[model samples]
Target: MPELPEVETARRGLEPHLTGRRVIEVRLRRSDLRWPIAHEVRELLPGQRIAAVDRRAKYLLLATAAGSALVHLGMSGALRFLDAGLKPAMHDHYDLLLEDGRLLRYSDPRRFGCLLWQGPGTLHPLLRRLGPEPLGPGFHGDHLWQLARGRTLAVKAFLMDQSIVVGVGNIYAAEALHAAGIDPRRSAGRVSRARYAMLAATVRDILSYAIERGGTTLRDFINPDGQPGYFEQELNVYGREGQPCRRCNARIQCVQLGGRSTFYCPRCQR
Candidate 1:
């Protein structure tokens, strides 16, 4: 699945083309995606102008007067901007015909992505409990420290928790932990405040840089322009099991933590 940076990259690519444009049509080729398509999408979205494009965690929001359409580019999903006259491919799920002779297309081979509704003055259930954005001012060392008190979960798993801080997925978590000189298997409650501060800053820095690099291109992720991300080339520890560590010349190791593959350099990260 596309992480926060990937989703944010998509939002940045889609905003200019979508904002202030009227949705002349809402083309839903199917009745559902990961779930049933919301009725308001086909009923109320046809005539509204997209006011803005925003992201929360890994989801995208296309804002309009009637309501906001929430989009999740689940595994194998891609959104593209194309000429309105183009024909749809087999996996092309939906299209939003714009007034300017362009269309925003959604294609998801796995169908895990979703198109849902958020009425005015309301927050979607999915968005309600998510923690502050990792890049936002609200997330910092103190926040992590507070939530981590007495928690025995591995630090890497703690960082990947959406309710703790949104968008620090597996790849970035491993890289950030390695950058901060912290082992992925360290106990969340055992990590010191000072180390937590360093970890927090590293997470912010790594995520900001990753977004700038257009996000990591793992599996099916690609920017809205159909380009793969450049950040994957810069990875330090993630997916480098048995490879030499870039920092300490130690062998990179991998272990399962919270059911996900966790990677780290035994020497550099400790």
Candidate 2:
């Protein structure tokens, strides 16, 4: 699944092509993606100008007067921008025809992604409870420390909680934990405030660096131009289980924590 940096990359890629453009047509190759693409989307989108492309957590929002179209790129989903004449592949499920003769297309091999709506001045239920974006002003070390208090979850699991700090998915969480010298298996409730502060800063730094590098490379994800992300090569842990740690040459280890693969350096992280 595309996480925060990946989704944010999509938002940035689409912003220029979408903002200020007229939605000349709304083309649906199918009626549903993950859930049924909202029925009102067809009624609301055509003829409306795209005001902006924004992101909340992992969802991409296409803002317009009618409402904002919220998109979640689940596993194996990609959004590509193309010239109007190009043909869509079999997985291409949605498109927004632009006045500039461009088309923003969505394709998902697994069809787990979503297309939903948020009416003006109201929040969508999908987005309402999301914690502050890790990259946003509301998130920081102390806030995370407060949330982790009394929680028995693994520190990594707590960090991955969307309600604690949005968008710190498995990959980034492992890397951030590794960077902060926090064992992924550490109990969230037992972590010191100073350590949580370091963890928070590490998350912000890793994610910011990821957005700059075009997001972690995933088999199903690509930039709007079809480019693969370059950040995977920079990862410290995530998929490097059984390999030597970059910092201390300690062998990296892996375990299942919170049902996601947890990677860390036993000697360096604790």
Cα lDDT for residue 226, candidate 1: 80
TM-score, cand. 1: 0.97
Encode model 2's per-residue lDDT on 1-270: one tens digit a residue: 788899998888888878899999999999667899998779989999999999999899999998999988887788998998788889999898999998989899899999999999999998888899898899888998888889898999998889888888889999999999999999998899999889889999999999999998867679898788889999989899889999999999999998999999999888
Clashes of 2: 0
Q: How many residue pairs clash in each candidate?
A: 0, 0
Question: lDDT tens digits, residues 1-270, model 1?
Answer: 788888998998998888899999999898568998898999999999999999999989999989999999877788998998899999999999999998999999989999999999999998988999989999999999999999999999999999999988889999999999999999999999999999999999999998999988978788777888889999999899999999889899999999999999999787
Clashes of 1: 0
Model 1 segments beyond 4 Å from truth? Answer: none
Instruction: Score each candidate by Cα lDDT.
Output: 0.92, 0.90
Model 2 lowest lDDT segment of ten: 217-226
CA shift of 85, model 1, Å: 2.7
State the displacement of the C-alpha of residue 36, model 2, in Å, after optimal TM-score superposition: 1.0
